[model samples]
Target chain A: MEEDENIKKLNPVEMKLLTHIIKNEWKTLIRGKWVIGYGLIFLILTDTLLRFGGGGAEVLLSLSNVMLLFIPLVGMIYGILYIYQSREFVELLLTQPINRKTLFWGLFCGISTPLMAAFVVGAMLPLGWHGILAQDPGASVMVLALGGMLTLIFVALGFVLGLAFYEDRIKGFGFTIVIWLFMAILYDGLILMAIFTFGDYPLERFVIAATMLNPIDLARIMVLLEFDISALMGYTGAVFRQFFGTNSGILTASGMLVLWLAVPAWIGLRVFKKKDF
Target chain B: MNNYKPIQLHLFGGLILLLLAWTSVSEASASDTAADIVVSPDGPVVSIQEAVNMARPGDHIRVEAGVYVESNIMIDKKLTLEGIGYPEIDGNLEGHILIIAADSVTVSGFFLKNSGRSHVRDYAGIYIDKAKDVVIENNRLDNIFFGIYLSATERGVIRGNEIRSYERRESSSGNGIHLWNVKDPKILDNKVEGQRDGIYLEFAKGAEISGNRSNNNNRYGLHFMFSDDSVYRGNTFNKNGAGVAVMYSKNVDMIDNIFENNWGTSSYGLLLKDINDSRITGNRFYRNTVGIDSEGSNRVIVHRNDFELNGWAVNIKSSSRENQFTENNFIENSFDVRTDSPRNPNHFEGNYWSHYEGYDLNRDGIGDVPYRPVRLFSIIIQRQPESLILLRSMFITLLDTAERIMPVLTPATLIDEKPKMERIR
Candidate 1:
């Protein structure tokens, strides 16, 4: 509601300028052929997985594994590289008398939306074609929702990195890869280290908090909780007397994920507004 | 002198009538020695105990429809106690409803309830001891400590009985059909629920238990120890605290049974411990914590069974050796087979595993490459169960993929050499 009022406060000329920039971003994204290619990759992967990937639920599990590994990597790399490649375009836009908020929202939506839409639609079309939508709609939709949230989150983080290292492109690329590697791999290693370090004390709460901190881990947990409930259920009380993937757990994870999607982008926007470039 | 003569003549008349009644009973059947004695609420014989007292060996005592508040009604004669209209025999929280101490006794079509619980006594709706050729069937026992207790009996038939109780704790509850030191017992077509163990057997040999639905019990649906040469076929055990457990038994045949939805930390569809030379075939184990937990079990032939959606389909411990698993289908379990030790002596062949990614190139039904059932994650789980929280995580999958290419932590020899290309129906 507050956002709408702020948009309403803008005059007709500013509104036209905002819409014009957003339109230009969308046009270039479509003509770039990245979204179509991204969609095709998911399409073939999902189709092949559905056909030969151990019948029904096995296929879904394999697809989720692939999506968890690839979605964030693609989203972040594409987000940062898009900004680096389009630096001249951004500069040219700044020369025009446009509002920075309008430019920020335009760039944020322009890069994230196409990738998110391509992923969700590509993953969904094959499932519907195979009647998995009617068969097990809850799990299927949950997988897609997790993928969508992951794309938004990683892309937002990408924008933050892109803006932070605007002066040095090589440093920006190096940091983005390191960040992805840390979030995806090293974070888990750190968690294991902590668990082993505090093996005697009840470190279940610490482990869960650490997992929730990583957006990729949160997404993977959400998808696995839906598919492999029984095995995970066995783990819950068989060792630690803690619960995993309850309805409340899913809700809290999603709330954290929404924060993940917004904070990094908000930080990037703040930096953009204050920069003297 | 005249009064003595008259008394003697009356005694002589009574003796002649007794002889005629004896002759009539002998003319009925070759071995029959009595007549049908009807006991009703309004009849001369008002109670079942009174009817049993008056009946001779091989007599038929028909108890009509009435609530007979009785306890410890002992049948010492070889008689048939038949309930005509489903008569109720309420134990009134006292003790055993009926005790059969004689062989060739048949108790059927009775509604027995409320045999009081006691720590010292093995109270039951019907307690049979040291009897042979006994049949207890077509009865409904409710709120019993032990539904039907048989001990030191031979060739006993306990069939077509529905036993139910309300006790939730195993310490307070007792088994539905309790058999001990019995031989050649036929337990068939019974439904037992909410008991400690649905059907329990110990020191029982040549027992044939089939067509039973033992569900939702406090402990195992069917539990047997030291029971040799027992056959469990066509039984459905569901939602029990632990599913059917067979321990300290040999030459056991378990066929065509369904064990489902038994979910607990230590629950299993079939827990075979210290069992040897057993045949487990044609069974469907679904959605349990573990399908078959083979611990200290050996020489068991596990064939043609369907294990689906379990935490671990088959958890073969290191102590269990020389067991053969063939022509079975392991589908959609989180881990197909898990073990702690890497030294495996058991054989897995011709089973269709859903996790198997091997292809068949020779146009044969079996795959060319061997499929390893044990994964690296399961090994980690066995050692550090806390790592189970990382189930389905990317690290575990990557670790498993790397280990599959090079056998390191998992059981190196535990591979299904002849994996089926397609599911075995």
Candidate 2:
């Protein structure tokens, strides 16, 4: 009964420090020059492409190219680097009377929130300025939402990898690069080979399932569904339209994305709780 | 203006004299007194069928403006069936409104509607069978199975008619102006919409189809099968299921027509299948899925035409050969040329492609370097259609650039050696 009282008394102080940690992280990221530089890069890229891309849909497609290729890479690398750099700070915090769960949650929120803010501010400024968001609200919202989700998912993945191998920084960095490469490039190649090998089978269900397995493919199919150019897509596109054309399909895809974000973060939190400083 | 009035008066008097002499000659040729039989609601002959039955050869049946519920009004003699102020002929959704079984017949200025829809028989607003020198003109046909049908007829003229139907499916609809085994039919100044095919010709020879507007049909705007030695000029075909299909025909002259906005998976602005010796000149094909799709066609001269903003400017299949694509302007198409086979035998020369990047060093009108039109990406798309989603992606751009530099996988023979340096104006 005395131990329970002591633990209850320590919870309020840790909760107070959690907010402080979050605020400090936000200020640090905002004050950094790289945040503004990232925003400027996105603004220029979107504006220049919009000026020359001939159409709104074309511009969005080009932006999607950048988003799919670079967002995960940037998110994953940033997550690992930030966690690794803040190892001393985390160690210093552990020496205090704060609970491990509170520190881990505080750190996770700190790192991911700034990265997400950077991405959102960077992407939304140009899309809003060019009236792309207004012209096609559904597609623009989808693109932004998918980009944000990818940032969160990949960041969580980076965190999990970082916490799992906290002692070896190089190993953590190497794994992050390999994961990004596998998800972005090699996954699509494997899908193509599988489709060609199973060409004769009725592979619509299998194809849809496989797309859900890769977050990038899911995002691409979602955007393609919005474009409504099914004529170009001969048959598989017809299947995608048939499935994703409904409200249920959209709901399910979003639910899957949320679950994707939650699973890795949950696993990372568990690992952080048990890991030695 | 005041001095020309006397000359104008003199010209009017001469024209009146000519008209009187022409009427006398026509009267003498008939060799019988042509009586004007008026059919009104209160007249002795209250129905058009009775008037047509009472009329003899070389007679005139003037139908007064009233709702005449008639079906199967067969004319078996040479008669002039004229409608005064566009009389309404309601078939009561039963059968054909009028059937012309005789030669030298004229049925004009009537509003025909609601011919019966039948699968066993082909119902029409005006059906002419085995008739020569028939004139079915200035008629308004609505909600019909077939608007105007001419079968085994010679020297028929279907002019100045408006044909429309509210058919949603191709199986339930019929052609607007359907001709079978006809010779020398002059189809002019007609507007057709919402039918299966706006104008269909089968086994028709020496037809002159001009000044017609056909749009929004369930199938081809203008379809031809075995209709040889025909001419279609100054017509507009727009937004049909497939714009126009000319198959199994030879020596067809298609000039100065406009085909626009025929967009679908397998649609084309113009489809030439098994056609030979055709001349498609001075036409505009704009915004179609495929501007022109040719299969099993040979010796086709596609000259001085404009193909703009289509998915594929020209999709020529392997079976097409000896076709000359010369002096045409291909502007802003997704792919300027797409072919199934790797080898192209058709000649593509002196054409201006908007995407061509070659330079002219000698200040001549032609580019020094040849332009290869068939891209390796298009071949990949043909093999794997789902790769179309990767269109304009960086990976696709990289692959296309690599293929362009290496000249591998794309058709080597499908090059324009004499690409025009400037846009063909």
Candidate 3:
């Protein structure tokens, strides 16, 4: 109840200005060709994968692997770059009688929604055209959903970075790439290192906890659930299966992903609200 | 003295008289034809025991279509027990259904079931002891402790038997086809399921096991120890509890076999332990926990085998040495090779590994750069098994890449120097 009062709802004027800003942002971003270009990249990736990858299951695996590595980087870079590129427009809006919440959410939605659509549609077209959806509709839908979640989560992350370092472009770009590298590479490396270093301990619970810490690993494990053949996973895979528990596992992962999305966008909005343009 | 003696005396006297006449008649018609002893449900001699008691050495005892509830049906003469219409032989859970104690015996075309389970004795559907030139074929065995137990048998052929059991525990069940101290026992075209071991060989030499489907057993599909010069080919062992294990065996030729889907904490498609001079060729190990776990195994040649989607294609323990893996296609396995030791003495050459990303220059079929199958992360997994949860992690990929460029932690000698550009058929 206290939290409900803490959330400030927009007045009618703020809502009108918010919708206007969202419409204009969408127009500029769509007309800029970056969104369509980002989409075409996924089209080419999925098309090549479907053409050369051997079986139906194999193509889906390849697509997920590529998606896991590429989606976050693309999403974050797009979000940060868009925020920094429209600096003049954002500052000019700051001069008007506008609420910060209106501008922040409008920009966030405008940047994230199209990129999510681009990734999903780009990947889905090749698979549907090749009739891979008929072979394994469940796994295909899962890959697209995971891809969409990653895009939204990373875009929110990118917004926080953009708003935090708008004045300093070099630091902003540097920190953005560093964050991507940490999530994509260093986080997993540290997990492996910890596993090897503490080899003598009972590490099952530790490993699962570690996997939950990283969004990428969490996403990958979710994909692993879809292709959870008992043989390929061996004994270790069995432990993962027991813990994941199919439906509950997906629920927990999706919940975590939602949390990941909400926290970052909330922080980015907070930064936008107080930052002096 | 006994014009009205006990029925035992009457039966004994009648059997002696019949055997004397039958032996004399069989000697006269010896080479041309063996005599026929028909045991029908409504005949003068209805029981198979009564017919065998009245027959000569080389007679054919034809059992007509009926259920026989007798146990310990002993065949002590060199004769044939042929079932006319797959007559049921129920042991009533008492003892062995058929005990062939004589040489040159043939038992075929029967449905044998419900042998007695004892902690002391191995009650089987058909028990052959010290027999030579015996053939037990075309029989269906169900709910048996042991399906076909052959001990000290020479030149026996056990073929086309469908053996199924329902015992879930290994201690209560016996092997489907047990060969102990046997020579040249050709096990052919049998389907054995849900037993301790599908085909077990202990001290069985020069045995030929082929064309069998053994799946979902309590323990191993094929478990052999100290069996030398045996050939296992054209067999499918799937989803067994521990898969196949060949221990302390030499000159083992395993060709064209499919070992699939056996996943457990310490299971493998084939576990070669303390064996020497074996050839694993043209065998497909698919989706097993470990395709071939070699420990103390030496001088084995693994050629042209397809290891597909297994957890580990080949896991070589520190004690295994001098094994050659060549021309094999390692496709999409979670880990191509894992070794406990960093100093690998076994050779991996000319194999096509899906993980090999080296380029083939000079238009040759082989890659210019040698491909190392063991990654640093696999070594980490060897030490820490729980780290396998981090499989396909990007961090592990980077570590593997850096470790591949500079030989560190992983065995440098474990390189496939002449890696094939394409998969070997």
Question: Backbone collision count in every prediction?
Answer: 0, 0, 0
Candidate 2 residue B348 Cα shift, in angstroms, is 3.8
Alpha carbon lDDT of each predicted model: 0.86, 0.83, 0.86
Model 3 chain B: worst 10 consecutive residues (lDDT sum): B26-35
Candidates ranked, most accurate by DockQ first: 3, 1, 2
The DockQ for candidate 3, computed on C-alphas, is: 0.32
What alpha-carbon RMSD in Å does predicted model 1 have with respect to the real structure?
6.2
Task: Give the poorly placed runs of model 3, Cα more than 4 Å off.
Answer: A1-40, A46-62, A79-145, A156-176, A196-200, A222-277, B1-67, B82-86
Could you give the fnat of all candidates in order? 0.28, 0.03, 0.49
How far is B340's C-alpha from truth in model 2 (Å)? 3.8
> For model 1, what is the error of residue A16's alpha carbon versus the real structure, in angstroms, after optimal superposition?
15
- DockQ list for all candidates: 0.29, 0.14, 0.32
Identify the superior model by DockQ, candidate 1 or candidate 3. Answer: 3
After superposition, candidate 1 runs with Cα above 4 Å error: A1-47, A77-145, A155-176, A196-202, A223-239, A245-277, B1-70, B73-90, B102-111
Report clash pairs, candidate 1: none
lDDT of 3 by residue, A68-124 (tens): 998999888888898888889889988987767788888888779889999999999
Q: Worst 10-residue stretch by lDDT in candidate 2 chain A?
A: A227-236
Put down candidate 2 lDDT per residue, A9-120, tens digits, no spaces.
4467777888888888888877886867876787788888776544456567667778888888888888888888889988898898777767777878877877777767
Docking class of 1: acceptable
Worst 10 residues of 2 chain B by lDDT: B386-395
